[model samples]
Target: MQKMPQWADVVLIPLISLILAALLSALVILAIGENPWAALKLMVEGSLGSTYAWGYTLYYTTNFIFTGLAVAIAIHARLFNIGGEGQAMLGGLGVALIALFIPWPHWSLALLGGAVGAALFGAAWALIPAWLQAKRGSHIVITTIMFNFIAAALLNYLLIGALKPSGSMEPATGRFPEATHLPTFQDMFSTAETALFRGAPVNVSFFVALLACVAVWALIWRTRLGYEIRAFGQSESAAKYAGISPTRIIVVTMLMSGGLAGMMAINNVMGEAERLVLNAVEGAGFIGIAVALMGRSHPFGVLLAALLFGFLYQGGAELALWTSIPRELIVVIQALVILFTGALDNMVRMPLEAMFLRLRPAPKPARKTEPAE
Candidate 1:
């Protein structure tokens, strides 16, 4: 009954789009007077060359997974939660407060506390926008975007006046207690007498991101609340007729989205930086939008999309470092990928549908035996 095979829609389309993007990127490299093949070889060597590179790639991938899931879940509710940046900022505040004030005896306990604090703060930041949209009919996108700026300003004021440590000129808080330090991939692998992930920021939080992907998948596909959320997203009037409350779904969805975004701080702040700093998010929030879009809002799709962006991030840094290519070209490459995957998706999709249609066998005429019978 489908015009195109399911595999084509899910896998083939994305693969082809990626290939197109890569070809364009290669052309761009050639225009810059560099060998495209050599540039790509450098990217692969730098990003996947060794355990050290994998460490950074996975580290960045961990953050993307969290934020991408945040956007994906919200998309399921037909809500565009652009406030991930703001919610993540507030989550860092929560992590800082917990890691600084609480006397956790071990990193494990600190991680638990930090996750709770991050989720709570992230959800709290999203609450106002949810209420505004649910109760006052305000647009979620506008309200959430506005909240991002508000969050940044609020964080700035707090850091300068209250959070900043004495004798420190920076706007960041003091380092967390040593007990709060999360184990790096290096720390875990070194005990085996084999060095892997040495000097990389990838940490236990990568596993946490994986767990989150599994959890989100279960929540979306195997739960009654998820059914209602999807129903509400598909048709608000139909959901209302079925007695599902729009306000409730909207608020709950946003909270979950915000909570996921907030958890990114645990990886970057507690796991990697060991201290709360300004711009800890580093634009991962916006990148989540593209990830969610390209992944079709599926958890598994989001994971793969996150890894792809992670590769771009790590590889782009390497390109800038070793080649004459301006770092801005990397941004252009990313934009091209986003454009093909998200905005211009129909450009590829329509042709594929037509081809599939043409490839199908024609219907057979009725047999003459029917008339004889």
Candidate 2:
């Protein structure tokens, strides 16, 4: 018998965690001499109020979606692929190479090429760590984390030397070809008289993120490989007995995870910046961990969680801009949300499960057994 319904696990638990995070955040604001209700109002107004705001929120959402899916996939295989930061950096390098060198006649072709490059680069970065974990006794967590620094250093070297344009001091490559420029929301949605998403960074890559979600959903639920991944996650010994190879599952899952993380570059680099630059990821790679945790490693859940964090990000920026609250306050709020959803998840889940179990009606006592007749 289940302790609670599936719906409760998927929806109710996260919702409660979010509310608790919000309440505690409100208290924090009050302690800082700000009105909680007013602050909440401002956040809503800033993040969801206008098309301009929605553009920023959705832009952030797009990045988080890719990174969140990246993390969630590895999570299903019980692997902590925190090297998303490094993988994504390499992906950006790939994007830069393709966008700067390839003379694409159209943006669509460039976008496709950029995606392929990003995925390849990201997957390549993950390959070493995956191989180490699968073939050696090396721990994946430590290996992946160490790789992040390596990626950073490698990127720094290339940016300052090989990738930098001659006579230019900037550590980033020159602007991408004009044909590679993506159509932003304003370009796609504006009318003659009015503009939507004006000056916003959101672009067609958002659709790519959505497509990724659908693909991941199908991969996890409808594919044999996914079944093996989940089976391995559930019990390596049992999966081994069933003919599933742990080594194969780990390598494949990390590759997919790293590829997804790299895809984020198509949004931030090709779409928004129109060029690859250092720190282009803006910590979205790490935020993806919280997104995956809150979403419980489901694609749809990752989408919703990504949106929530996107809102918090844009809203927090607005809050800091207009109020006395410092920018770091948003970080505090994010940390609190992570604390409740990730670390303290059992605090909410256990209580809810017990309540639901108690609410279930007692089964009727078995009829008294008389002598067999």
Candidate 3:
């Protein structure tokens, strides 16, 4: 028998699983007395049917890219950094405080201040759990999870008591000054015929996200620091033998991870909301875990996975407008993608191995006769 190809195992498995999931979801729609074809058509149309939809997709993609990179970085170090949500929230708070209180005559200065403030706050948040893990021998998963709650409480107190806009019952801070806000392409095209399209909220942050992707790819592939991180990830004992300090790597990994997450504050405070608000992170940090997993922790893969999720997020809302289907379906689909991708290694390996073994040549009868003799 001819040898089976290897790429089939790598690429085909994911493709088949996704197709199966879509078919299953369609069956579900049919069972619910809805037209599966219509629902599928609606899903596509809502996501990619127009420039407006594409713009929203890219907007959400920017946030997902940052958060996904944050999670992927930690995962590469073999750590489960569940505190991404908290880190992002604190980062937003940091940026908000700077933008609100600091008077900057130039937009460049304000933007830089906000980014730096967020990075510092996010680093601080991750440091707590990193310290617990390295010094106290606490499991990072548990420590990070607990820190999320603490962050929530801290944010609530600040939003309500300290940063609350005067006369507003909402748990939010005052809007940033116009000078501090990020500029978008839409601002220049305000009078164009495609004003609505031009007025869309896409901003320079998209380029920031792209730059981040390039930086992450370079860090992992070209830098000595990246080698150490990968070594630690593959085996702690081997890394230690190679003179890599596990504790230092752990701390550095968490810090870098949190710093990337901090950049998501740009999307929240600079692009979308223009201010800090309670629950502003809105679980993007957690969704990022799924994105990283779906992307198999590769930088470019993360970009593609993030865009897929972005489509689901923005399009799912538009889909709800035309169909009775709940927007929660998007969450369910996201969960399914993560579940499928997580099982991909096993799914690809086991079946291919079985097929290969079955196709192998049988042992010679002469060998059996010689053994008997």
Candidate 4:
């Protein structure tokens, strides 16, 4: 059999997977006595039909972009850093502390404090599992999964006891000071008629996410560290033979990956929420894995995939307002996309190979006298 064309895989695989997922979802919608067309129309209209919806979608996508990059970086090093949720939560804690305690006269200082605090906390969260994996040969998957539970417990304790606002019964910290709050786009959209629609709070986090994507692209495709990481992912044995230390690579990759997730904490605590609220991240860390997978672990690809998820989430939330379809149905769509992408990848390889072979020049007819002349 001939080899598959690389371009064919890049172009057709995702398209086919999306089409298949849509069809399957339509069937499922019918089974539940809902019109798929209506569901889809609602999704599109609610997500992209208005400026407010677009702004919200962008906000959500920014979170996904950072977290997805984190996962993608670890994946490139052959590590599955499933502790992104924990890392992000810890980072949020750090940002909250900074916002609460740091007396910054300037907004710039506050923003810097938040970024550094989140990065430090995230890196620390990742270090524990990295240490276990490197020193004791522990399985990262097991350790990271356990760490998520630990983080949740720790966060609940802190929010209820240490960080809870004085005069509030809710499981959340005090609102950030005015200096620490992210500037919103509300002022830019202000008009005479409807102030509610104008006061939408979108922040600079989206630009930060875009910059992170560029940095990740450079790190992965333009640096020696990235090459070594990719090498390890392709084959650890080969990487070892090539003198790349797996332990060091593993630890660094996890730290960098977790740091990116930590940035998501900034988007939450500093950019959007401006406070430490329970479940503030809203499962964005786990959703990041889906984004990374759908994007094939590429930085730019992850950005697009994250945007798609953001649209789905915003659209699904709006759909729930007027329809019987459960919001959880969006999660079902996400799962189907992942499953179909994997399955269709295998199915398409054969056809891609045939097409590549047909496009290649036919081998010169073997010399008739090759046997003995």
Candidate 5:
């Protein structure tokens, strides 16, 4: 009964969409008086040519994985938790507090502690919005959006007033204890003279992101709660009739979403900066929307989409550095990808669906006379 195979729906559609986006992007570059092919070469060379480049690409990909999973989880429950930006900010605050005050004997323990703190803080940020949506019928999108600004302001106040290290003007916490310093790729892969990651910021957090992808997959496809969440999402009325609680599903799904979003801080703050700073989330929260859309809200899809965006990010930086293209153009290119993949998805999908339907063989007519003979 399906017009397209499941493989085609999941893989072919996105692949074609990306190809179209790329062709259009190339035209745009040519129209702007730049060499599109050259730009492409530079992007590949810069983002994937060397271990150094892969380090940066993977580092960005790690952040995207966390945020993408966060968005995807809420999306599965038919909820739009746009407050990832704010939740991540609060998660950083939690990380800062733990890393600065607690003297963990080792980075492993510190990492565990940081994960707990980040998850709790992120979940807390989403709690009120989820409650309001479930209990008061408030719009989750508006409430979560408002919370982003509130989180920014709250972080600004705390960093400027209470948490700022004395005699330091920087609006960030002090460097974390040495014991909490994570092992970098350079340390893991190189000697004193030779280096793999070199100056790149990729760290153990990348592994954490990978593990999270697996965890999310299991949660979505292998767990009872996940079934209830998906059932509620598919039809609230039907789920209610089946004895599933809508309010409970909404609150729990948002909590998991926010927790995933918050854990992103462990990568940027603990693994990279070794300190909490303002704007550390760096719009990864918003980019996650596009990632989730392109991935169709599946964990495996999210991982691939996250890597693609990560390539765009790291490669775009290289493009800006080496070509006449303005840095803003990189953002424009990213937007176009998001446009074709997310907003304009049906533009590509509908045609493909029609073609596939037509390709399906027509049902043969019955031969009644021949059958009787």
Candidate 6:
């Protein structure tokens, strides 16, 4: 009776999209006089061959997870949050300030403080746009994007001025103190016989990202406020008739979305970079939009999508290093994936739905009319 099953919607469509993208990408490589099969093998080996590779892949995945959740939560509220870049920038600033000013006795305490600071600053940055959209009828997308540029300019000024260490020429804050340095995967998994995740930057923050996945899942599907959010998203007019305040939902949802985006700094700043740098967010915010879209805005889907993207990123880098394929080609491949998964989603879904409908068993015929029995 259903057009298609839930599993098909969540898993099959994405799988088909990936295949289509891969087929197109293979043609592109063949046109360039390269072997597509070899390239695929190389990518697999580079991204999954060893713990060292997995370390980098998972690190990127962690960033995507946080940002994807940000976008997903906003989508559920029918709000488009395009300011994750700015909010994450502010989050990095928060992390830098806390790391530099507070002399924590341990990394654990610093991490807790950094998370709070990052979330607060990120939420504060989103507050203006949320207010404008909720109260003044301004568009959330426009306001949030404008805020990104503002955040960038503000970060530039600080890095070149107050936040910069004395006599450092780089446009980045000085190294974080020793106590604030997070433990890497190598430290956690290595033994005297083997050095796993050697030279990899992945750290404790990856677990934090997983925890965030759980939390977002709970917030979106397990709570009362989540129901209200879904209701508002499904039909704003109906929600108003049902007494759900549009202004409150908009403000609260944006705040939560921004907070999730900002928390990404806990990985890149507190965990990987160990210092606040210019452009530390590195376009992870925008990638999150694609991630959320490809994931259908569900937390578990986001995790899987993030892992796929992480593989692409790490694999693409390997291609550039080991093959004649240009890094721009990798970008094109990633774009193809995004294009198919997002803009062309209906192209895949419609066919699958039709196929499922055909495969469904025909219903039994009604019994012939009989006298009341």
Indicate which candidate wins on lDDT: 2
lDDT of 4 by residue, 247-362 (tens): 89989989998889988887878888889999887888888888887788888889998999999888888878879988888888888887766545677566767777878866
Candidate 4 TM-score over all chains jointly: 0.91
> 10 in model 1: Cα distance from truth in Å?
0.7
Q: How many backbone collisions does model 4 have?
A: 0
lDDT of 4: 0.84
User: What clash pairs does model 3 have?
Assistant: none
* Superior by lDDT: candidate 1 or candidate 5: 1
In order, candidate lDDTs are 0.90, 0.92, 0.81, 0.84, 0.89, 0.90
Give the Å error, residue 22, model 3. Answer: 3.0
Q: Which stretches of candidate 2 lie over 4 Å from their true place?
A: 365-373
TM-score of each: 0.95, 0.96, 0.89, 0.91, 0.95, 0.94
Candidate 2 TM-score, true structure as reference: 0.96
Give, for candidate 6, the lowest lDDT window spanning 10 residues.
Answer: 364-373
Using lDDT as the measure, name the better of candidate 2 and candidate 3: 2
lDDT of 2 by residue, 7-88 (tens): 9998899899989988999999999999999988999999999999999999999999999999999999999888888989
| Clashing residue pairs for model 6 | none
Reference-based lDDT, residue 306, model 1: 90
> Looking at model 6, how many pairs of residues clash?
0
The better-scoring model by TM-score among 3 and 6 is 6
Instruction: Give residue 115's lDDT in candidate 1 (0 to 100).
Output: 92
**Alpha carbon deviation, residue 50, candidate 2 (Å):** 0.6
